[model samples]
Every structure is written in C-alpha cells, then in structure tokens.
Target: MHSLRPLIALLSATAVAAPLRADAQTFEPLSTCVSSLRQELPAKVKPETFETFTRDAQDLRPVVDTATKTQPEFQLPIWDYIARRTDEQRVAQGRDIVKNEQAALASIQQRHGVDGATTVAVFGVETDYGRVRGAYPVIDATLSRACLNLQSAERKDHFFTALWLVQEGVVRVDEFKGSWAGAFGMTQFMPGTFAKYMSAADDKGRVDIIHSVPDALATTARYLRGLGWIEGVPWAVEVRVPPSVAQRWNATESEHGCLTQQSPVGKCRRVAEFAVDGVTRVDGQPLVRPNSLLGQQLEPSLNAALLMPAGAQGPAWLVTPNYQAIWRYNRADAYALAIGLLSDALRGSAPQRTPWPTDDAGLSRAEFRDLQAMLLRLGHCDVVVDGASGPKTSAAIRDEERKLGWVETGRGGQKVFIALKKSSAPEVACAAAVPASAPELAASAAASAASR
Candidate 1:
C-alpha cells in the first residue's frame, strides 16, 4: 500500500512546480533503482530495445491510476471541465486552422519573431485544433518515470528527453507517441522542449513540425524565439481596470511601493531605467515610446514579467520577456492563457468581450451534461462527463453553490445550469420525488478501483 500511486503521478503539475531538483546521491530504493540505473543508460539503446521498453513502461502505471480515478467517479461537473476547453467545436476548428495557415502563418511571423496569434494559440491550447495529441507511450511516457526512480533528477530530465528524440531524427521508435506527459507535436512539444526551441527555415527553405504548415508555424516561432520572444511585446492583455484600480496584483514588488497598479507607471517607469525609444516623464513631463515591434522597428534589451493569470476577476496584462518565453512551451496558467488567448483569437479577438463570469444563459455541452447528471443525482459528485470544470468539478460546484444560496461560483455558469435544473425536478409537484438511482454501483466500484 505504500504506493500513493507513485506520489500522485509525479506531482501533477498545474502551475509549473515540476522542477524537483533531487539529490542525496540520486537516492535509490525503487527495487534496486531501475536495475542500477539500467547501468548508466546509453548503449545506443537496444537489448531487445531495453526489454521492449520495460514492458511498455509497465503499462503506463495504470494511467496514473486512471487520471486519479477518472476525476471523482462520474460526478464530474465544472460544466464538464469547461465544456472541454471552451468548445464551439473547438472554436470552429480554430477558425479553420487560422484560415488554412495564412501563407504558413505569415512566414512564421517573418522568421520567428513569434506571434501568429501565439502560434494559433499554441495550436489551440495543445492538441485541440489538431485534436488530442495524447494516447500515451512517448517511450512509455519517458520510460515510466525514467524507470520508476521517480523524480531522480526529473526522471533523468525526461530520460534525456527520450534520448534527445532518438538522436534528433525527431522521433521514430515505432513513430514515438505522446502525452501522459511526454508531450508531442502540433504544439505539445516536450522532448526537452523539442531540443531547446525547434525552428524550420520559413521564408521558404523548409522546416517541418511533423508535416509542415511552414514547419509548425516556424516551430512555434522558433520556440518563442528560443524563449525570450518579444517581437511586438504583449503576450498578455485584457486590461480595463478602474474600480479605483489597485487589485493587489500578486503583491510583493516590495508590496506596492514599486507603485503597483500592476506596474502601470507606464510600465514601472521604464523598468530598470529607460530605453524602449527612451524618454520618460508623464507626471514629471517628457515622452517618446516606440521601443520595438520587431518587424521594421526592432529593439530589445529584454526585461519583462507582469503575468495576471486569471486573478482579480480575470483579464489584465503586461507580461514580457516574451511572456516568460511562453513558459517554455507548456507550464500552464491555463497553458499560458490558452496561448495568450489564441494569440488574441488569431488576431481577430472575440469570445472575451469581457463576459466570463457568465449566466446570461451560457451553459451548453448538453447543459454541462445536465449538470453532471445533476451532480450524479445529488449525493454531490462522481466525476466523468469530460465537459470539464476540473479541481474536482470546482469542488462539487462549490459544494452545490453553498447549498443553493448561490454565490460560490467558481463558474460553471447558468448558475450551474440552474442548480442542476433544480436537482432534476420532482421536489413536490404532486409526485413521489423519484430521480435518484444513478450510482451505477458507486460508479462501477470507483471505475474498478481505478484499474487496479
């Protein structure tokens, strides 16, 4: 029983914490530590290909115990996990893959200044526009925790990132595979970030990201110009402020004496003393501003970080240093605000006409699976419907929106489909109440005790 499912599937990251430095001489114990570190790896990889890749990395440790028991046993309902990533059929197939890849996304934004709407919002938030690049087995999810030695230097840093994608032939050992955290193409990346920022020569000399749309939009603008991406700045925006401003904005920059209205003293008064086209003095009086848009007017000295990750009630932006270089591809804040709101909705920018605390009747996916089948007929939650509202269906829709007095709203909206359509009717209307019975043997014994 000591297997807390390999420490909750290696600390299921939601906010970049996967760093885990590990040492005590790379500790041992997971049964003679994966056969003494498979004798320090690399022998041009084969011994019946390391025993059929350790029997397919011991069959994906039961999909991290079936995505943590399918999220809570058929009681799932944050409007079925945000209606599977804001679906309107995945935003009308991400507006036809941004209009049939506009000349391969404007020659990958003129050779990697990185913007084609944040590379089609990182191809519409990692594999939706391409549609789910994850079934698993990128060398069985990087040798199943680098052979279950767990965080041993971040699973030998994703096991030498699947042996540097098979020594740069960019994946082929049964055509590799992806996600259960190995991440793959069409924006999921992660072969040590596609070998530190992949790019293919766009103005036309070829560079493909598994089948060129000008090499996956210039290998995601040469992996956000090797993670310092700043071309025209703004990978964060949605500002509208004015409730007399000061909404804390993640405090500590010496608690606001850095004049924090989220650093708007025209960007911390030329943050670190002047030069974007240099000239400062608003209340003091002088102006010039035009630093660099990167195209015909480029100028970067690099220094930015203002991230507003959906707090203080949602949109607000400033983040730069090419927005933490798109958090090295996929370290979420809703995966970098869905690739900075699909690069401002592929330059057209809608869906956020500032109405994300919904209720003017916006709750579909069959009303979020009829409010997760009325939160599994009312005993609260059971998990799967996959419309997605996550964090245990916003803690069972904020515990049934605090027992109906409502206000808890971690948002599934339409008041969680009118409180699960008033818990699927029959409360008094001249009938014997009924409706309950859908437990399916405690959701089939919690999905068969999570595939054990």
Candidate 2:
C-alpha cells in the first residue's frame, strides 16, 4: 500500500468510526489547489495540460478525507478482514476466472514468472475483477487527495499523472475514474504506477487496463514480477510451532512485526534453521519443502521469516521472500495473507488450518448478509442485505450485542449471527427511533421463515 493510502482489511471492532462531516471539513479549496498546482505541478506534466484538465476538477475532499481514514486494514479485526475477503463466493469466482482467463494467466506466468492465482487474487482484491472500480473521477480523486495533503509529493504526482493520461487519450477523459486515493483500472493501479507498468501483455498496442482484463492482469503480473515474485513458490506456508519457542517469540502487541520492521523470529533464516528451531509444517510434511512445494526444484536453504499474524500460539506462517514481495506490494500483513490464502484456495488448497484465538469469529460476506437479514427478522434494524457493514448495520449489531449483555463491539461477528439466527421473531422495538409498527409487520411476515 502507498504511504499516502495506508493499510487494508476489515476495520477492527475497536476502531472509532469517524463521522463523514467531521472528516470532510479538513481540506484546501478547489480554487486554491488549482492555483497552487499551476505553479507547482511537476515539469513532466505540462502547465497547459494541468490547466485544461483540472479546470473542471471537483472538490472531493470531504469524501476522500473520510475514505482515507476508513480503510479496512486499520480498522477491522484480522480474522473478519480475512473472512470477508477470502469467502466462498470470492473463491468460487476466482476459480471461474482462473478457468476463463487461463490463457492470459498462463501467458503472464510464462512471461513474468508470476503465478496466475496470485495475479487473479490481486484482481479480486483490487477491483473485484473490475466490478467495483471506484466512482470518483481520477482527476477529482487525485486533486482532492493532493489538496488534502499538500506536502505529499506522491499525491501531487498522481494528480498530474491522471491529467497527462487523459490528455494523451491513453485514458479517455470520461473513463478516468478510480478510488479516493486516485488508484484506478481493473487492478486498481495508481496513476503514476499505471504510467510506469501499464504496457500491453501481448505487445500489440497501448495497454488499456480499464477496458482489457489481460492488460490489467498483465500490468499486475509485471508489477509483482518487478517486486520479485518467484515462480511456483508459495508466498508463505502455515506452520506448527512448538510451545517452547512460541512462548519466547510471541508478541501479540506487534502482530504485524514480520512485515513492519523485521521478522519477529529475529531475522530471516534458511528452512533448515526453522526446522532446527522446532517449526514444523502444519500438514505433516517436511519443514524444508512441504509436499505442496515438492517437484518445484526448491532447495532447503530458501529463506523464510516467521510470521505470527495472530500470536505465536495462533496461526504462524513461515513466509518466504515471495511473501516479502507481496508485502512490498501493499506492506500490510492481512492484505498479503488474503492474497496468499485466496491464491491457495484457487489452486484447490483447503481453507486455513489454524483458527484465530477468538471465540466470536468472523462471518463470510454471504454469512454477513444472512446476519443482516436475520437482524431484520428479529427487529434489530432494517438495513441493506448487501453484506457491507455500514453505520446502520454496525449500530444494529451493537443493539443485538447489548441484548446479549456482551461488550458492544458493533461488529457482525458469529456470536451475533448465531444469536440472531436463532431468534424467532421481533421481541423488542428494533429501532426505537423508527416507528415500532414497521419492524413488527416485517418481522411478522418473516417470523415463520426465521424460526427455521
């Protein structure tokens, strides 16, 4: 992830939700930004190009500012984030994509030494295989971020790059839309990143990442390859750590330490070193090269760092330099783990072996939707069943949590899901703010169905 953008994942239950209005108020005006940029725009972006493109730029500071703070990585619990991102529906869709786009994926692997699953996993995570390329115009989004952070050279460069892309007809002006932080395309590349790596995979013409799947995947593969993604090598492998070593190395306070400063196991070591230190493969395979890694001509001396995303007692992965490459892509352990797990799932690997240390486990996207629907039946709150946890959904879940006498986390965890699932009908005023009759009628209609 960009230093400007921050981390990825489901926002933690403890994260303080920022109201949109409060966040939006912090920004330089559009007129002020345009004036400053006219003089300070990078030399690579011609002054006239900046003037022509940003003339109609919208002040998106309010929305962008809120979005920057609400990134899931910094908010959601690790388990919830992983469950939502690597759920069954996403896995099935990834498999279908792997089948349909096999040729392009194969070509990418051949050309770049990047695996198809990893490439497609990035596709799934970035823009949901091009389904959810953001709504903000790249010009507006970039300009908004630039105005928000005047000292950030990356944000300013991205804005000008967006302008240059539009002016060159490489990206149509109408199609220049992306995230609040200004990343766009099927694989959500920042404008500057796209300019550097967005070449056609087939070498036929200019890469059209917005319109071409192969080109988007190609750009992603190229980036990963540039980041040193090793072919046929896993990013990491789930491992079992002996209790003796686990006690000494476990640092729940620094859960993402392996990716942040250095490995928590102190330093990167050869596979033999890990085996010697009592780290064993989870699947009863050799520590040096597990069965999943066999036939790849892998050596025992391949470097790996111990990654305990939860704690030493919880799931730990012996992450290789391949994991380092993926971490370099986003610099978040959860995001890299998502990519690793999703890619493995696409390749017919079973789900995660070791569970997180929490009893109130996370729900999948579909299960989350079901929870929302069940909440509606139990008169918890009337909200969309889209599975995205918004203010209304969180508040509703908190109400249910309060009813159960648990601490109010407001997260749609399995505890709330199971409780709501078993509740037959509306027993209380769902939303005291809303009319009591509304929830009663809806719950009455769905009562018989909810009982089952």
Candidate 3:
C-alpha cells in the first residue's frame, strides 16, 4: 500500500507537470520561429535564404502581436454576428464587389469551385474586405506562439510552416505580414494552410496572394477544393421546425474527437434520432426522415447535420458537407454558421422562416446588479455585480439559469438575463438547488451589462 501511494504521488506529479509543459507554449518571436528551424529543416535551402528568414521573422513581431491581442474578447452574439454580415448593407456591398470583380471571381470559381459568396465571406471576415489585414508582425506572433509552446501543437506547426514558406521563396519575409494566427492575404490562410493549398499559378502567371486579388481569391478556392467542397450544394440552409417538434442532432462521428471546440460531446454511438419539420417539400413532397436524409436521392444529394446553436427555441439549420468545409476553415460552429448564413444572405434571403424568440426583453446594468444581489443573497456567488461579468458573475448567472427551467448555457443570453430580471425561485430555492456553471449565458450577460 505504501509503495502504491508513492506511485500514485509520482503519477499525480506527472499529471501536474503535463499541464505546465503544455502551458510552456509561448511566443517564439518571428526571428526565432524561422531562423532556428534552419538547423532541422530539409538541408537543401541556401544559407542566405536562412538568413533572410531570420531577418523577416524579426521584422514581423509588431504585426503578429497586434493581430493576436487586437480583439482578445469577441462579444458579438451569433444572431448579431450573422445578421451584420448578411444584412442588406453588406449584401449590396458584396454585390458591387462581385459585379466589379466578376471576371476574377468567376475564373476562380471555375478553377476551384468556390463561389463568390464564400470568397466574399472570407474576404469580409478575414480583414474586413482586406482594408485591415492586420498591423502586426507575422514573424513575431508566429515565433511568440511557437516559443511559448503553450497548449497549442497546431500553432507550433504553423510556425514552422511559415519558415518553409520563406525558404521556398513563395513569399519574401518583408511581404508576409498578417494575422497572429498567420492567416494572411484577402482569404486569411494560416501559413500551414497556405503552404498546403496555395497554387503557384493563377490564369495569370502570378502565384502571389499578397498583392494580386485574383491570385488570393483563387488560392482560397483551391483551399476549399482540397477540403472537399461540393460545387453547387449550399453550405447551410435555413429550416423551420414547429414548436411541437424537438430536433436532436449531432455532427458526424469522429475518431479523433468531438465535432465542437468548446467541449467534447463524447463519442458518437449512432446517428441520433431527432425531430423534423412535419410539413413536406415545396412540391408537396413527403417529409424526408433524418435517416433517409443521410442517404442519397435522385435530386441534389446533400449530406447535412442539423445545428441549433441558441438552444431549441432559436434559429435552426441543416448544414451540408460544404458547411463542414467552411467549418474546416475555422472550427468554431458559430464562425462556420456565420459564414454559411452570410453566404445565404449575400444571395438575398431573409432570416430563417422559423421565428426566433428574441423579444424576451433586455437586461439593464441596474437590473443586472439586482440579479447579482439575489445570487449573492442565495450564497451562490461571492462576487460583486459591478455591472460586469467576470468569472463570479457568470457563476451567479448559471446558478440562476438552473433555478428556472432554462437551458444551461453558461454564457449569459437574453433568456437567462430575462429570467434573472424576473427573480423567481424554483420550488426549492437556492439552498436546495444544485449550482452548475453557465459560461455562455454569463458571458453574454456580462456583455449586455457592461455595455450599459
């Protein structure tokens, strides 16, 4: 037993050290992320090329840090985030960009099968139509993240891939400044993604994405093609599910891990059976079952996964394989959904036919303070409201959500905020209630409160 205890102690120490090792991932600074790689890189590059990468990486620090910390906390809700991109203003602007740049976008679509909407969405999202590619030094941020060697293996890969790009002379160090994530040019591709998908030649001889609009858009299309993007199928489609139905959905099974980034949803045992719209197709076709939906049909066969990010009462979607392709661009469902929805909006479609329950009322700062008071009174939270949601405020909001029959998204949303404003106790009150974390609701609640 004593021997077992020491073994257990050693195992615990290793467990603790593992996280420390992971957190050790830090910024390497552009110079080091590149120059250091010459020692291990394929020994074919000239010594002068290595020296050039070192110099370029050193100069890229300013650009990298600027991009990384520029928006440490993105506060836009899915609805608002999707809405802004798909709004009439943006759609009209996209149309103009497309009309003026048709020949270029069409040529790219022909070669890569990536449509203008996807191209535009990428351009709009990456740097707001390339108006702001970022003010950071790409080398510095890449090096910083690579050196920190923190909990990011993927980022480390990006660092070295950047070095490869320099050695290959695909892009000189001077012209390579971009986002901290190494997502550069109009389409925002990380160095590794760029290295993999960037074609050396467009219809024109230029392979450069930094200066050439045609090359960049085409390169983005190539990336989508490499990711198995379907040509004509929509990325995602707006769906209407009646209140009587409950739609249960899950992403395809993954041997690697869960389909989401926030937390793992566990292994997929079988395709989860979910509710569907009882109504049939526009042609008076019978409603297709979820199981049958997975199989191909005579019409355009689209393998889709239903997504309901804002709980059951919010907007719903049937995201197709192309949607997953967009998700491959960025793992966040919200981001992919935004891109997919924006694609639809750019094509001139209204919001989902299903009515979103958005009119539950807003939570003001004072009201939030009151909600915080109730939470602290119940001993679930020991922090002040201050009209801001730090960790404790979120904890309090989660406690409140569980009290009501609300869905427990840790981040604060309008529903949780409204529920907090009402201040009603479940049958058992706080003492008897089991407190659970609600990060999503508290996150949103903090935003709403702080704005006021």
Candidate 4:
C-alpha cells in the first residue's frame, strides 16, 4: 500500500491510473475456491451473498502475480526508501493539508486519541494525500489472490473476507477499487482491518475512505488506536551515539542488544540507560525538554529501541512503541521510518543531521537490474531481473561477496557492482570474440597459444 517513487517522473509513471480489468475467462481455479468460501464463510457471511458474488467473478492471475513479485520493500535501500516518501515537496504538501483540514483532524484526534500530524502522515505516505488510490478492482484483486493461492493462509482469509464484504453490500463491488494487494480506500485498509475498525466522521453514517478526507483520517486514527498508539508520545527521536559507546555495543557480539539478529533495531532500554551510555538527542539537547512531546506527555520511564538504518556509521534513532504502531500499518522498517520522518517534518523538524555512510549512496532501479543480471551470469542467482532485491537476490549477493573475499553483508552497492563488472569483463570479451558454433575450439586455441 505504501509505494514510494524515486522522483516525480517515476511517481507519475507508477501512479494509480485507469483500472485495467482482466479479460473474462472460465477462471476454473475459482470453482473449488468459491465452494470452499461458501462452506467457510456462511457462519459470518450469508450463504446467499457468497453464491451471488461467485457468479460474476473473473480470473486476475496476471495482475496479482505481477504485483506479488515486485513489491518495493525488499528492493529499495533505506535512504532511497525514506527519501522518496518524505521528500521536501511531500512534507510541504502535508503541512498544508494539516492546516486546511485542521478542524476535522483535531476532532478525529480528540475522538480516537491519535495525533493529527501522524494521521496526515499516514494519508500522505499511503496514497500521496489520496491522489493515487489504486486502480485495481477490489473484487478482482482479492478473489484472484484467494483463488490462486498467491499469499499465506491468513492473507487469503483476508481476501475472502473482502469478497464477503462486497457480497454483503458493505462496499459496492463496482466502486471498491484499490491496490493490487487488496487494501482499499484513502488510507488503504485491508478488508479485515476495515471490518474491525471502520468509523464514520460525519452524521450520514457513510464511511467512505476513498472519497471523503475526514472519514479516511478518522478511520486511520481509529485503526492506529486499535494498534496501541499512545496519545502524545513521539514515534521516534533522532539521536547521537558517542563513538566509544557505539564501540562498546557491538551489533553482532550478542543476540539481545541493539541491531542484533533477534532484534535488528535493538531491544528497548529506558531513556536513563541510554543517557548513561552517552546517547543524546540529535539536537545536542537533553532527551527531556519542556517544549518536547516527551516532556509534555510521556513519562521518563518509557522504553525505546535504538535503531541504526545504515549500520553503526549512519544516523541513529530512539524509536518508541508508537513507532511499532506505525510499523503495524506497513511491516517494513523503511516504511515506518518514512512515516515518522514525514510526521516530524510536518511539525517543523529539520532533516537528519547525519548522512547515510555509503560512498555509492543509493541504487537506481537500473543499477539493481544490472546487479541482478550480473549475479545471474555468475551462476549465483536464478531470479528474473525485475530490479527487486528479494531473498534470492540477497543470497546471490552474499555468495558473490564470499567469492571475492569481501564481507558478506548481502548488500547491493557501487563496490559490488564494480567488482562484478571487473570479474565479468574477460568472459564477456571472450564470448564476443569467438563464434558460437566453435567456442570450445576458440578457447582451446587461445590456451595453446598462451602455452607456446
């Protein structure tokens, strides 16, 4: 649901455009699927509803399969991920939305016990202030995923529930369109979440997140509250970690501390504990201050996890449980960080003081595709070159790193690209020089000439 494009051009290219419906087909796979749904859903959903909806269902395997393979979370670097979501232009636009919708946001916050800025941040990031609610039909997407077994059991259940919602007339089938993942409306609520937490902001009793700003914000606020969002706590605070303190806290030495295997963002420690370790707010001020949100509302005893997105040399943050609430909206760490940073910017906070510690900075989609191609040629990976650095791609990178005697971080960067280019150049040259029919002979002749 949280799609971040690198620039405006990319955003326009990928932005939700006109709906592309699948051509009608027999959809043979869904026959048993509908029968299973009829048996499984009747207790909660009426049997009549299930029977009626299945009559018109069509296959959408192509669209659903393509989306499943290309999610940005596993591909984009942390910096690129955050930058695209929390761009300066987006922040400025969000601030304007906060100002224009002040009364509605304030009321939603008061009722739901969630902050206005955070709600706006969700809106801004999820759909770019509702400018790009996805163009895929909800029924087509959900039913396709359910019938084709595109996701896990629990996720398929959600898709089935969405179909049930359509059948029951809770959301009209024709009007209900959203992302390929089946999350709908302005804030992108999955059917299960919508069924549980949908709320109307006006007296009409119509909760339309797709069309109404107030309703969407209110629904988002209510959803966050259900996720344990504390009323006034800051999601995260940028921090400065002393060199000596960082040296003492080795990320790989223990499985329990910050940035460990078990807790990649570190375990939560009390603010006092961080103070003793010489960690301070990034602004060179005390962790608690009169004007700060923590000083105004949160207790000193609150625990926060230390997060370093780009290893120890990069910017650091003390992320609170409120951060977890944001993460619940989307499970990716980069997504959560983008929301937090965007929310901070809306409140007039400055950008990160410390830059990410990498010479190459970030990978473009083209660069990522090139990396995948090189890995494939080297016999390290077998995935399609779609620019997404998924599990197979990461494993391949680690394998290549090991071959080069480099540390196996499984990260894609300029160094890896350069090394791969150098390693592959001779092979490329040799293949280009020899005729395809007599490659072995050409190689043998070259070897003989070298020996002579």
Query: TM-scores, in order shown?
Result: 0.31, 0.86, 0.60, 0.69
Q: Write the per-residue lDDT of candidate 3 for residues 75-102, one digit (tens) a residue.
A: 3344434443455555666667767778
- After superposition, candidate 2 runs with Cα above 4 Å error: 1-11, 14-25, 247-266, 290-298, 380-382, 427-452
Better of 1 and 3 by lDDT: 3
lDDT: the better of candidates 2 and 4: 2
- Model 1, range 14-117, lDDT digits (tens) per residue? 21111112323343344454565567665655545555455435344434333433322122222223334455665666768778777777777777677566
Would you list the clashing residue pairs of candidate 2? 1-330, 8-73, 9-72, 9-73, 10-76, 11-75, 11-76, 12-75, 12-76, 12-77
Q: How far does residue 128 in candidate 2 sit from its true spot (Å)?
A: 2.0
Q: Per-residue alpha-carbon lDDT of model 2 for 1-452, expressed as tens digits?
A: 34332344345654423333335255546888788878886667777788777787778788665655565655778888788879889889999999999988888889888888888997886656776666667888788778877897877877888888887788998887666667777777778778887767787888899998889889888887766677777777788988776666532213423433333345556668768888877876667655565432334667667777676646888777677776666656666788889988988876779999888888998998898777776665555576665666677778778888888888888887888778765555455433223212121111111000
What ordering of candidates by lDDT runs from best to worst?
2, 4, 3, 1
lDDT of 4 by residue, 154-198 (tens): 456666677677776678878787766667787888777777788
Provide the overall lDDT of each model, using Cα atoms, as 2-decimal numbers: 0.47, 0.70, 0.50, 0.64
- Kindly give the number of clashing pairs for every candidate: 19, 10, 34, 2
Candidate 3: 10-residue stretch with minimal lDDT: 1-10
Q: Where is model 4 more than 4 Å wrong at Cα?
A: 1-28, 148-153, 243-266, 290-298, 360-452
Two-way TM-score contest, 1 vs 3, winner: 3
